[model samples]
Target: MADKRYTTEFFLTAAEVNSQREMPLSRLVTTIIDTATAHANKLGIGFDRMISEGISWVLSRLTIDIAESPSVNRTYRMTTWIENVNRLFSDRNFEMTDAETGRIVIRAHSTWMAVNMSTRRPGDLTPIWKGFDMVDGAPSGIDNGGKLLPLSGSDFEMSYRFAVSDIDVNRHVTTRRYIDLITDLWPLETYDSMRISRFEVAFKHEARYGETATASRMAHAESPETATAQIAVADTPCCIARLHFSER
Candidate 1:
């Protein structure tokens, strides 16, 4: 039997870090997705298996809470496991820890669905998940299936054209690119002033290459630490996200 959990190790490199030499939010989120993909593949329920059946994994929602962002050249470890699964959606959890000090760098939860390639509809998860082990009841900071907070009073807006490089194997805009686009709305000085501590996003629709999209964001009324943003194409929301910050 395969282990119910999976882990991988890596060090922050130039490619994953920003100008300040800290790992960017998008890179950290990419780590979460990468670990999930590797584990899913190990369980025989990942991309290769799903794609063969005319299905692909679609990220529905994700929430990442970071305690600290590892600096360049620092080794870290990431572990992930299946928390729960239903016919329509699966919940996965992850933890990132400093390899030297054993301190946690991040904890995240994600929701994914098996989508039919042609129909663009969610497919049943039961058939392939029949014998998979789920490590239910583990501590997860973010709950699956919660309502995504809407972006209100987003007075800032930027129009963008989806570039060819942003397209992925799914023939749609890569999710990571959307994250970078949203993060770009803030000036570099803002990132220097505040550190993103938590981020949550809900995927609503797909944006394709050559499509034009608008990114909008605003600070929440309650505190300077909170923010909300939305990405849309033709005025239809493609994805929405909220980021929580903490002063350095």
Candidate 2:
């Protein structure tokens, strides 16, 4: 039988890096998502196949820890596999390592649900689960809790208008795009002086094209290096995230 895990290599382009010459959090997320999508396609459970059946995979929660960020034009290998699956959701794991030195750069875990595209209701994944090899490894050491509470108050808030480019095959704002919007709330100086050690986000609702969404952030009083962001469209919440930073 073929191994249940999949691995792929990526070379970061100039556009994927920030002024600090390292991969930005948002772009790193996009790479992870892309790697997972490619792995799913190899397993015959990818986005194209799912959408054709009126089912679309929605990311419910994600958590990532970065030990190091690869620089522009550097190559890295991403390995992903299914850690477990239930009727309503599946837990996936990912690891990015230096292609040459074999040092691990990032570890991540994500929870996803398959939903009926038209009804927007969770769909049973039992049929597809039968074909997967259900691995017993979670390199990220993060729980797939899928819980993110809204921030009660914020120090700053920003609103953004979604563009056509933000929409994905599911006809909603892409997960990577949402992360980009959330991280954009921080100024360049923040990125220069601090590094994001951990990031957690929960997707609550879907934002469609041309919708206006607001993002708000509040630093934790107890843990000054930690903060939370709430993203909403109109009055409906879309995503809530927690970011942990450290001096670089």
Candidate 3:
């Protein structure tokens, strides 16, 4: 039973966005991660168990396809589940929808590896799989196409002053918080109608609480019918965010 499913709801706040009053893409992704983690905890398959058993899950890759953006005050629902666990890694799937219309706004595919806590490196997943059961068939028909925004050029520029709340147990701004900042730059309407089909971000430098950091984006691709964004920091690039939109 390594696979589990979950759902959650939360408010979209201004502090979660930039001047355009939209929820940052980074924040949205963070919420999804947290919600999924909480769901696993509720089912007794939490992170604590994984770590204590000499194994922990690490997000090796993530691909988010956004079809629509959630606006402030709007109620949104998120559903997540484990697709499958292999000898070395596991695949997780996520779906986001507008609570009101039930229209899917986002979808994601993430690859995870179980690591040995003592060794601080990847470990075999066989022991981890023995504790869990397959929920059902694997996630089918998910489009694995698209790319994140290039973290370069002058088309976009911004930054954030990390607050006390931004710090995690690791003493650095968490990965999800960074994703929130990037998503916040898109327009509400654009966010609502677009679905992120691919989102891949990696952590390099760590930003401490109360420290200021700038964010920048490059136009990887744009058109009246579709758009993609690439986000980064000053000189050092952090992640690439690709957003696929639906025409209004």
Listed in order, each prediction's TM-score against the native is 0.94, 0.92, 0.70
Give the Cα error of residue 243 in candidate 2, in Å. Answer: 0.4
lDDT of each: 0.84, 0.83, 0.65
| lDDT tens readout by residue for model 1, 1-248 | 77788999998888779977888877877878888999888889889888778888888889888899678989999999888888888888898899999998888888898888888888877778776665565757654335766565576999999998999986889878999998998999988877888889899999999999989998877786777889999867899998888887
RMSD of 3: 4.6
lDDT of the structure predicted as candidate 2: 0.83
Residues 1-248 of candidate 3: C-alpha lDDT, one tens digit per residue: 33356788766766665444556666766776787678668766578878778887666567777666567767788888878778887777888888888898778777777778788667887865675664444582466554443454545567688888878986867786677776665556654555444455544445677766666554544343333443344555545555444444
lDDT of 2 by residue, 146-220 (tens): 467887788999989889998986688987778887888899899889888889988899899999998899998
Query: Candidate 2, 104: how far from true, in Å?
Result: 0.9
Report, for all candidates in order, the number of backbone clashes: 0, 0, 40
Clash pairs for candidate 2: none
